[model samples]
Target: MGEEMNKDVTIDTPYITLGQLLKEEAVVGTGGQAKWYLREHTVSVNSEPDDRRGRKLYDGDTVQVPEVGTFTIRSK
Candidate 1:
């Protein structure tokens, strides 16, 4: 195998789950509560609180933060 690469994706229609964003992503913390808190606290698109960790992201939405980089939805 080789070093894993995170692909750059854009939303044309929209996706409803954070898990759907990653190929092998996992929540890191003490437990579900902690994970929930992390999800609640962090995770933003275009400087907006992505309340639903399972929110369907739409085009023009930008996922940002200390990590996770930025995900911009492009025309497909």
Candidate 2:
């Protein structure tokens, strides 16, 4: 299989929630989808399993989704 794509997301605030990031990145269609996605799949934050939809992702944090790709959080 080909390598997953890399995406950089910049937020104006200090941090963002996992669900927000997923929805913003279009990973999931809706908030409900983000919730369902988190429940059904394994999402890693900094290489650790992160199931919390509200998990705070600060600047420099890395979120890796096996199917989607990697998301790097940055402050704007």
Candidate 3:
């Protein structure tokens, strides 16, 4: 399969949860799916393995899933 395109995600809040970011980016269809994906797959936050669904992502944070795409969080 071809790799998904990398993307930049803008957030208005002080921070966004990892699950929320996945859902908002349409990487996962629902919040539950996001959590399930987190549990089943490896996700990297700033090059470190991060599985916490509630992990807070602030501006400049980069999240990557091998099957999906890299997402860089930016302030809006």
Candidate 2: stretches off by over 4 Å = none
Report the lDDT tens digits of candidate 2 across residue range 1-51.
678979889999989999999999988988889889999999999999999
- CA shift at 37, candidate 2, in angstroms? 0.3
Whole-model Cα lDDT per candidate?
0.50, 0.93, 0.91
lDDT of 1 by residue, 1-76 (tens): 4443334565555453443543223333333443465455576667876645455555555655334456564546
Candidate 3: where is the Cα deviation over 4 Å? Answer: none
Between candidates 1 and 3, the one scoring higher on TM-score is: 3
TM-score, cand. 3 vs. native: 0.92
> Per-prediction RMSD in angstroms?
5.9, 1.2, 1.0
**Model 2 worst lDDT window (10 residues):** 1-10
Question: What would the C-alpha RMSD of candidate 2 be, to one decimal place?
Answer: 1.2
lDDT, candidate 1, at 59? 56
* lDDT of prediction 1: 0.50
Report the error of model 1 at residue 7, Å: 7.7
